[model samples]
Target: MGQGGSREFEGGPEGFPPGSERRSARQAEEAPQENAVVPTVLQWSQGGQSVYVTGSFNAWGERIPLRRSGNDCVVCLNLLPGTYQYKFIVDNEWRFAADQPTVRDEMGNINNCITVEDQTSFMREEQPSGFFDNNQNLYTQALPDEITLAKEPPQAPSHLWCLPLNFPPLCEPHVASWTLLPPLGVTLTHLLAAAADRSTNTLSVTQRVRSKFVTMVFIKPARGSAADARLGPAPAGGQAAGGGFALPQLPSTAAAVAAQQQL
Candidate 1:
């Protein structure tokens, strides 16, 4: 066969080997993940009816039982990058491993200590690249070795506020405009539309159900509900500046608008 044709090769495609591409892809997939967890194993050699492990890993809230291996008790955990303090519970008795490092707490109780480092060294590497600018949500923060949550929610601000239940007649030339413009019975749409607005006051209404299916309108002031707006400096003036009416600003802006309509 002289210079006429070419022979097929065992490797895939031209010049490329079959397993080379696969090997590269497999290596890529096997690469360590960001902030990857580290596997930790804890063991207690003393024999007992049941051995449990509890510590900072779960705030000591959940107790994980250790599996028996010969006379030794063992437990394996996948933990994030952080330092943890723990203790062993042997037969319902609190204790720490005598062989491991130990530290005393503020309460004068001794606890074992373990530090779990990230496999990928994510904590050491330059923080995630995508977090552009000072984006608070995306930007990472240096978290302390310890984590804790408040036992109770913060207290609410002390402020007084209320909306007027009764509204004055519509400002239209004909009093019937208020009734005819809005269909049949009163609805939320109309109530808010006719309600007065004050730059310094805010109003909100809630419909409540009665024993006989009667819809009762409950008005409430929302001015003080805004933490930012409430704290901001109050505006200067008594009244007589707004287009709706020059009535004095009251706890209920809706009531002031109604009173303005009367005049």
Candidate 2:
């Protein structure tokens, strides 16, 4: 009922070389007799300095790096028939291609999605039709049963939990505190999942939690100017006065938020 659930998805027709793949949304309904892997290529065309993709295939653990192709970054993978939700990390920022199919998790976090169908039915559909584009893909929409997986795993359990706005994460202060603000000139409102930078030793907390704003906070550095403390509750013995926010709740005023910048 756990990772075993993922196996049923991997059972499909054998995949061909990348150039031999077929693409269509209608072919999914006809489960022709086939058994092998499916070749999947994920592309990020938003233009970023660096891009990598990660999702359900690897339990959302390791990010598969994408190679640059003109204005796009692309990666090809051998996946079995299944539904997967993924987003690209563009220049260390979490983002999804809005033009593609998307699904939101329980927390309203959105990610680009792809569905790989069996190869047999897919190959059979191209009966002497005009040649398909060299870059055509086989992504299809989810069937009834597969829709349930949209929420199966987006983030790990630690960051999956939701806390109401202004609710304290720990009774005492955490690391240093940095206010969260939307990127300048950004208007479309959407949720950004929690992420931590190990090299910078910074933790970002973002939660909507009945609030309209997708607010976030950068846990300040407990050390000197460099924030060296990890994001979490205080140490075992006692609380550190400078570890968390001085205020009982986050700043809520328009004046307070308008002048802020993300850490």
Candidate 3:
């Protein structure tokens, strides 16, 4: 039989330094079986200026510790899935973030909101081969439930509501006032939900009956502009204007329409 060469394991079979092997073994025992994934890092900077990020996640205004490289500042933190708003504090004063719906921080200050997508769902969709690129802003995530929405829409509460094409401004003599517009762009689903449902005669209605009122809005003629003389009037108090438009005893058979020429 041929002689077998002696084997030597680096740092010993304990897989640690010889003298400190006992302590290293203790540390390995204490450590969890699986290490957590390192959080994604975000770098914020503008025109060679270093900016600091701070917001609700880090106790509102407290500066998030960052590492500077050239002009860019970076921060990494493990954040749970949900909506979060943050702002970059540049040069200790100027705050910057996307301008849209301003989000309020925990300290009641407005900050820029950023949504952290569900990581698990996003990873599942991306699969095992590809990795997330830091430079990309848009990402795709999978929703838990099937996104099937019915096309059939709900019916409007009453046929009295009108949508006026010619909207007149407030305190003006005009027909087809802006008020006539049936709360522009209000979805049929929402209006029906607002009105009382007489089917079961649910008595626990919360909203008080609003009083009916009338007003006229006049659209001032554009300065020295040639346009048709337009004026409109509509029920000012919304559905409160009960007597102005009577609800038909028989529900509208058509695709639930609001009368236009009746007024």
The TM-score, computed over Cα atoms with residue i paired to residue i, of candidate 3 is 0.28
**RMSD per model, one decimal:** 25.5, 30.1, 24.0
Q: Write the per-residue lDDT of candidate 2 for residues 46-121, one digit (tens) a residue.
A: 8877677776565454666788888878899987687876777666667889879998754567877898887767
Q: 124-160 in candidate 3: lDDT tens per residue? A: 5543343444545334586637545537787855542
Q: Model 1's lDDT to the true fold?
A: 0.54
Winning candidate number (TM-score) = 2
For model 1, residues 1-263, the per-residue Cα lDDT tens digits are 01123232232222233454454345434545456778899999866676778766664546677888888889999876666777876765677898988887645667788877666754465644552545677535877575454367756333211122344446776567433222223333223322464433433333322211112233333244455365564445522355222333223445545655798
Where does candidate 1 have its weakest 10-residue lDDT segment? Answer: 207-216
Off by over 4 Å in 1: 1-34, 122-263
Sort order, TM-score high to low: 2, 1, 3
Lowest-sum lDDT 10-residue window in model 2 = 1-10
